[model samples]
Target: MSFSSIAAAARPRYGLSCALAALCLSYSLHANANTPPKIGGAPVTSVTAAHYYSFQPWASDTDGDKLTFSVSNKPLWASFDSSTGRLSGTPIPPANVGTFTNIVISVSDGTYRASLSAFSVTVRSLVNSPPLISGTPATTAAVSQPYSFQPAATDPNGLRIVFGISNKPAWLSFDSTTGRLYGTPGATNAGAYPNILISAYDGYFKATLPSFAISVTVTQASNGT
Candidate 1:
C-alpha cells in the first residue's frame, strides 16, 4: 500500500477515538459537580427573661446528600441540635439578660456549604406580658344606620400594639392601629355576624377579647305609625 493510503486509513480511527474521549470527559465533569445546601429561618429578635424561646432553621439539599449543621456565636443559655439546626432555651433572669449578636447558622453538604444571614437575639430583663383588650361590642345593628365600636387596649411594657379581628362582618371596616370597627350595614348585609374576635399584639405576646356577635335588623321607620 502507498504511504498516503496508510495515513488516510488511520485518520478515521483517530477521529473516532477523540470523539469518544470528549463524551466521557463531559459526563465525568457533570457527575462530579456539587450542589450546596440551603439554610434559612426567622428567629425572634427579642425574648423576655425566664421565658422559653425556640427556633429551627430549615435546610435542604437537591442532591439528597447528607447535610451537617453548624453555628457561630450561639447564645450560652440556648441548646443546639446539630443534625436539625434547632436553637432553643430559656434565658434566666439577671444572668442571661443581654443581647447576643451576629449569630449565624449554616449547613454543609460535605462538598459545599450555605449559611443564613447573621442575626441577633435580645433578652429583656422584664417578664413578658400579654396586651389587654376591653370593651363590649353592640350585639344589634340597624340596616341603613351608621354603626361603630372601638376596642380599648393597653400594653404594660408599652410596646407598640397592633390590632386584629377575625370573623368580621363584611359591612364593617377595622383600624389595625386604633382597634376601631366601624361601617354602615346595607339591607343585603342584614344577618347575624357571629364569633367576632378582636385581639391585640404587643410585639411578643397577644391578648384577645372574648368572642362577640352582631345581629343586623331592618331599620325602624323614623315616624311612628
Candidate 2:
C-alpha cells in the first residue's frame, strides 16, 4: 500500500475517535453543570391544618431547568402540596399525654433528589394538659339562675387560649386568656349538671383534656305546696 493511501485511511479513524471524544465530553459537562442532590426539608413553621404550612426544597440545574418533587417518607396525619409547596394536615395525638411525633418527608426535584429530612414536622397531642375552669359553685338553684365559665388551661408551649362553654346563658361571659368565669343563673338552669367541659387549644392544635368540667347541683327555693 502507498504511504499516501495509508495516511488517508488513518484520517477517517482519527476523525471518528475525535467525534466520540467530543460527545463524551459534552455529556460530562452537562452532568457536572447540575447541582448535586441535596437533602433539605423545613418543618412546618406554623399550624399545618388550621393554617397553611409548606415544605420547601433548594435545587438547581446548570441550564436553569424546572423542578419537580417526590416524597419518599411521608408522615402520618400530614400531606404535601408540591405545586403550591404546602404541607398540611390535622394533627393527631399519640396515645400517651403530651407526646411528640417526628415526621419524615422526602423531597425530589426530578433531576435532583434528597432523603430523610431531619426537620419535617413535630406532631403533638392536645390532651391532658388542657386549661382549667372555675367560678361555678358545687350547688346552685336552677330557677332564675345564670352561670358562666372560662378556659383555664396551662401548656408548656405557652399556647394561646380560645374560650368555649356549655349550658351558656346570655348573662354568662368567658375569657380564653384569663380563667375568669362570670354569669348570672337563668331560670331554667335549676337542674343538676353532670359536667361542664371547656376546651383549650395549644400550639400543636391540641385540645385541653377533661374539658375542665365541673359538677353542679341546683336547689330550688321553697315554693312547693
Candidate 3:
C-alpha cells in the first residue's frame, strides 16, 4: 500500500479506538454516579436525663459527593444536626427517662440515600431515695401531765424531711420539720391507743414506721389537805 493510503486506513482505526475509550469512560462515570452512600455501624448508647447527649455516625459516598444526615423517630427532647451527622440534645425529666428503640437515621448524597434502623438508646434518671426511721419513740404517757418525745429518721439523699402521723389521738400533735411529738393528755385520753402510725417524707419519696402501742395512765388530782 502507498504511504498516504496507509495513513488514511490508520486514521479510522485510531478514531474508533478513541471513541470506544470515551464510551467506556462515560459508562464507568455513570455507574459510579448512581452508586449509593454507605453508612457505618450504628451504636447503642446510654444517656442521663437533664444532661447533654451526643452521637456521631460515619458515612461515605463512592462518588465523592457530599453527604447529609438526618434522623427520624428521635426522642422529642433531642435533635439531630444534618451538617455534622451528630445527634445531640439535653434530655428532660420523666418523659425522657426510658429505653427507646427503632430510631432510624439516613444519609444522602443529593440523589441517593441510605438508612440504618432499629437503633437503641436509653436515658437514665436520678433516683430519689426514701427516708428511713432511725429509732422508736416513747410509747407511754400520763394523763393530765406534760409529755415530750421526738421520732428520729434519716434520708439517704440528705434531703429535707417532713413528718406526719395517721390515726393520731385528739390530744396529740406533731411537728413535721423537727419530728417532735409533744402533747398533754386529758383525763378522757386514758386508754390504749393502738392506731397511731408515723411517717417521714422527703421531697420525692416517703417512708412509714410500723404502728406502735401507747398506754396512757389516769393521773390523780393533787390538793392541799
Candidate 4:
C-alpha cells in the first residue's frame, strides 16, 4: 500500500495511551495459569471418603461474586455450592476403578458471563467380591406402593461401594442401565427371596475402583415405574 495510507491507518491505534493499554491487556491474559486468581487457590480434589470427594476453585476475576463447582463425566451424588465455590458429593456409587473422570466447575457473575475449570477423579475399592446381603426388601404390594431393593454388601477386595438392589419384587425392577433400583407393586405381599445380592466395585488401581457384592432392601409402591 501507499506510505501515506499506511500512516493514516496506524494513527488511531498508535496513540500513546491506546498502545499502552493494549500492551497491558495482552500481559494480563497471558499470565501463568497456576498463578492464583482473586479467590486465589487451586482446583483441589480428593478420593478417600467412600469413593467420594470434593472440588473447589480459586477465584481471579474482577467481579465480587462467589465461585461455583460441578462435575461432567462421573455422576456425583451431592450438589455444588455457588456461594462458596465448593463441590461436595459422592462420585457414582459402587466405585468403578480406573475410569477417567472429567468435571467442569464454572465461576460467573450470575449474569451473562462465566469461566470454566476442569478436574479429574479416580476411584479405588478395597475388595474383589461384590457386596452381599442377608435379607431382601418385602415383595408385598399396596395400591400405590411399589417395592424397591438396594443390596447390602462386602467386597473381598475391600473396595469402596456403589450398589444395586438386584432381586426386586414383581412390581419393581433394577435399572441395569443406571443402577436405579425401582419398580411397581400391583398385588403380591410376600415372596421366596430372603436375600438380594448386588455386585459392587471398588476404586482400585487406575480403575479408581473395582466390583464387589451387596445386599438388597425392598420398599413398596404401585406402578412398575
Lowest summed lDDT across 10 adjacent residues in model 3 is found at 216-225
lDDT of 2 by residue, 104-176 (tens): 4444555665554445344444433443433434334344345544334565544455655555434456665
Report backbone clashes per prediction.
0, 17, 0, 75
Per-residue C-alpha lDDT of model 4 across residues 4-47, encoded as one tens digit per residue: 99999888878977989988988877762232224334554545
lDDT of 3 by residue, 19-50 (tens): 99999999998876677899877564887665
Error of 4 at 176 (Å): 34
| Displacement of the residue 102 alpha carbon in candidate 4, Å | 2.5
- At residue 95, candidate 3 shows an lDDT of 77
Candidate lDDT values, in order: 0.89, 0.51, 0.80, 0.49
Cα-based lDDT at residue 157, candidate 1? 68
Point out the higher-scoring one by TM-score: 1 or 2.
1
Query: Which one is best on lDDT?
Result: 1
Off by over 4 Å in 3: 1-32, 128-225
Provide TM-scores for the models: 0.55, 0.40, 0.45, 0.33
Q: What lDDT does candidate 2 reach at residue 66? A: 55
Instruction: Give the Cα-based TM-score of candidate 1 against the true structure.
Output: 0.55
